[model samples]
Target: MSHRPKTAALIAYAEALLSPEGQRRVEAHLAGCEACRAELAAIEAYDALVEDVRSVEIPTIDFASMELPLAREAEAVSRQMIAQRQRRSARPWIAAGLVAAAAAAALWWSTRETEPQAPPRAEAPVEREAPAPVIAPEPARLTPVVTLAAGEVRRETADGEIPLELGAVLDEGARVGTGAASELHVRLADGTGFRLAASSALALARAREDEIRLELAQGSVGHAVAPLSNGAAFVVLAAGYSVEVTGTRFVVSALDGTVGVDLSEGAVRIRPPRGEPIELEAPARWRSSGGAEGGAPRPVSVRGLEAPRVAPTPVRLADARMIRWSVDGIEIETSGDVQLGLAPGEHPVRAWDARGRLHTALLPVGGAPVELSAGALQADAPRVRAGHLDEADLRPVLSRGMRQVQRCYELALRQGTGAVTGRARLRIEIGLTGGVQRAQVLGIPESSLTECITSYASRWTFPPPGGPLTVEQPLTLAPTQ
Candidate 1:
């Protein structure tokens, strides 16, 4: 057999083994391996030799076309045939082509198969569902043990101390910002129980019975009975008032040298100076010229004690001998001495306890007293048109000789995190030495900076030299994103 290559090499070129005319060339080669590939390089060499031979005073001519002698032409034809036969053999290129074709097919098929799936294993994480919603616990339903904090005092439920630093616990969720207040309700290791709400100023007196008793030394405090008992009693010692609590939750606020008690649902009795008693049923209030006999309100703690009962039907503020008691609801009139009436329930009474003063105490029957008193007569300052005021209306820093007077420019506002919207323009008059200092926004939600400014040129009185004038702009804040 002839040393012939297989058609796969042609197919490899036809597919790998082929070109545009590669199939025809391959078929022809298959038909006759004798016509395998002819080498043009040797033919060109023969043409150059013919040129050299004829260049001697003559032009070149095709030696193959010339009618040369028969023996010489035959010899040349045989030699050309031999050279063509030699070129037909592909001893070198056939082996290399087979190896290259095999490698190319293997590589193309291997890479495209399954490699794409591997990289996708590192895809982004899928979102997970959020946990279930947590219900805000109901105050009335918590287990008695869980109702109070391990060490929460004064208020209802206290977890780790409240975010608030100093606060007076009025009722369950109700409280006031006493100048300062601290509360604790810690469970004892032995299962014994203790609770405390230190007033801005505190006083502790001996107690009796299952009741919690505290003497209002010179301040006021709120207390809850031990172990979630209903009949918890506390004492409030304020400037000119004293109170004895029975079974209930109440808060006593001592401010400006006075004590005011507000009962949420429990009963407390107002004990005026000299051990006089004025009973306050739930929601009743009782206030006096002072929380304690001779001092400002102070916190009093009386645990495990009975509420001190007045032997006789105690004399109340209605029976204030030195300070007569006469009232038309909140507005009370006193001539020579101060008049006080301890209403039935909680009340925030405002009293004008000046030598010749009248106080308006809006007593909430059994609540705390809201007192409103007039300072020494203040002549009314002139008022200006609201549109005529501007930032210059702010009081000028006083100058004494070469010295400059300075005061803290406080931007007073309601400290809260909730948002509130405004629907109307609100106007407020800030009180000053003479009269209205600045007219500003009240109860209208706006920019805090805008409230600090005046609509026109205004004059204000900053007392002494370093004190600030209060801006009576009411604001509201709400909770949102």
Candidate 2:
């Protein structure tokens, strides 16, 4: 049984002609050997086919010019000969070939009697089937939905921005933005959630299982990422760099041309537009210098951020019925004046007074807590005057100052940090007296560079509009390499 059984042995085994000892041995071999078993089954199938062929009745042949009695006699003789030949062969193999030949002859004779003769000059036509068409595969549909939403969260649609609610299924490539006092939490099918903070926005980009990527336009997003499988990734694109992770919890922000990351668990890799990738671990804070000239994100010391503060700071709220605040993505609600041991970073705080008016502010927490009065909180926000300038009056003034803007960028480059280049958005207000009222700049990380640009922009004068007119202009700086 080390090798395959011979052909004759196979035939003998199928016919039950082998001795009991031989039968036992072949059966044992077949039980273990698939190839040998297949061969044996095939032999059995052939024998069955031969028996079916022998059982077919041979029909009487009829000639157009011959008598019916003579045709009947010829058919009877053919059947007798076939049956006699079948009885003569005891071996199944020999019997198979003879039965097949006899069956073919019978079929040919029967077909001749039933078919009408074709014209001598005509030939049969051949038919062929067309080749199968090729079909392309469709892409995978990833359905990440809004699991939790608070305040004013909106998703961008064809019509415009619509309010985003819980359980709303988000489509791939959709852009979602949060209001000044809003929050949004999106969960993937795999149970990972990316919570967008107040005044933050991000595009879904790609949400496939293998890779999930988001483009952060502005504001902050806290990510509570689930453990990912091998070869899968989760990435956040902000400013000119990307923060990629496998499975971790962290917060990333892209505010005023700066990128920052605060990791509390797991690890992440930050890839900047320039320089090598930096590996950041848990219980650490990293931030890029938010200035016109973009700087690399480096490990920075935040007292309450990396770890808990040693002491709790007393926060006094006068005449407030309810108050609420959020740390990471978790929300906390309390009543009356309360002491909060908040970390020394920017945290959003909200309170409701006796009149039910909501007052919210981004509290810059220090080692000690500060008193927040209802009137003082209201007064902290600036008031904006109505704009009276139109595009026709503001376009030329900005065009003429392009060289001055370039000079400001050159001055920033000559400082300690080298090659400062990026796009900055400048917002200018023209007063009724035609002098620049107020100027603000965004997108450039360097404060000195922005100050220089804004300072020159404010000196530009325009024709009196009889009212305050505000105009926003975009500036780009590309230093000569």
Candidate 3:
């Protein structure tokens, strides 16, 4: 009927072998139960005593003292047995033998110790150091922003080249390229605008808070830089030259191992591969040929010529020979001479002589009448057709023709006495056989370059088209710098 814990419960509590709930219950009971507490204390003392006994060495027994009692008892038992045997029969002898045996067993039981043995000590748990904490490296940070893209443009990234949409974001170190007859317009986060012409390749070298650097591998680019904070640097690397500008509008062209820069507004500093830095202002141009040797900037004279009073005035050739004239890129029919009006900008006027030789002249019209000679025309220039001709359809042919003409032009520019500057327009007529049937050049003078370009165009073959095609294209040579 007692509510106190049993001896087994006390042992369980001492060894911490009870469940959490049972231990809590036993602890609560012990707090108000004095009897259980005393019992637990006695059990703990007994455990301590057992441990002490096991730790101490056993002493040698006093064999003489132990043997004397057993000897006296054995002598008494013998004397009684002899006395009984003399007085009674053999049954009395048997009873005395049993008595002596009982006495010996009692003596042995009284000599032994009454304490319980201690349990074996458990082996200490093997200690193992916890594995070192795993530390992970921090990830790299990247800043990317969306920019404008147009016309067969693609960006080269870590995953390979991806076609760019109108507002695709580009990260630092992204390389952008454009196909033939294609162009790209992009604006940076800093409001700087970049216009890349066809067949161009550019790499965004760095885009950071303090600077934005670009590398121009080939072709041309126009930069319209916005105002910048002090110490902000905008640099462009092209061929063997480097262009550094704070805030300006300029054009950088890297072609045929030469780098040319034309400043339209503000000023820029050009650093050649091996020469002193050359500073240029608006309306000035400079070029270098992949070396440290720097060249002087040349002034581009913009004469404000007047527009003609009459619209579509008579264009009379001094020889009065039958010829064809084109305003802009459109061919015009004429019996002996052609009558055309001049516009307020540079107009590419082309003429075809009787022998089908092409001549071109770029007429800068301000507000007056302008005249051009037949020899000032260039023939067989590449042109972009109107309508929805797929760039894929036109690129291969146009690219090939332009490349041929460009080589000839570069050669002539290097060797010819006169400066080969200004824009030239070429009107090409592809025949049914994919050969150039008739080619005319506009806005450039008749020279070895023109003749060479025409001869090359005449022999050039294009992929067969759905029909005969007419293409008029304008080519601009970098001005002397």
- In angstroms, the error of model 2 at 182 is 0.8
The prediction achieving the highest TM-score against the true structure is 2
Q: For model 1, where is the 10-residue window of minimal lDDT? A: 400-409
Pairs that clash in candidate 2: 290-445, 291-444, 291-445, 291-446, 292-444, 292-445, 292-446, 293-446, 388-469
Better of 1 and 3 by TM-score: 3
lDDT of 1 by residue, 1-481 (tens): 7564553454354344466587666666656564233322234455688788888675577653443365356646644543332221112222234345655345334433333212212221110121223333221211011111111123213452332211121221222211222333222111222233433433333222233334444344555433334543445556556666544556676656556776655566776666657787765554555333333322323221221121111112321211222233323222222222232444443333334343334434422332323332222233332232233453342222002100111222234322344332324343424244555544444454334333321343433312223433233332223
TM-score of 2: 0.36
Per-residue lDDT for 1-481 in model 2, tens only? 4667567887888889999999998888789888778888889999999999999888777543354455466646654543333322222333335345665355334333321221111221110121222323323445566654555678999999998755566766899998765667676645466878878999999876678899999998888777877668899999988999987888899989989888877899999999999898886678877333334332221112211113324444443444453433445333333333444566666655444455666667665666555554542243344657677776688778777888877887888453666677888888877889899887767578788888899899987777778777887768877
Give the count of colliding residue pairs in each prediction.
Answer: 85, 9, 31
- Which candidate tops lDDT? 2
List the candidate 2 regions with Cα displacement exceeding 4 Å: 1-139, 290-329, 332-481
Indicate the residue-level lDDT of 43 in model 2. Answer: 96
Which run of 10 residues does model 3 get worst, by summed lDDT?
119-128
lDDT tens readout by residue for model 3, 405-451: 88887788778643678889888777665778887777888888778
- Indicate whether candidate 1 or candidate 2 has the larger lDDT: 2
* Residue 425 lDDT (model 3): 84
The lDDT, on a scale of 0 to 1, for candidate 1 is 0.36
At residue 358, what lDDT does model 3 achieve? 62
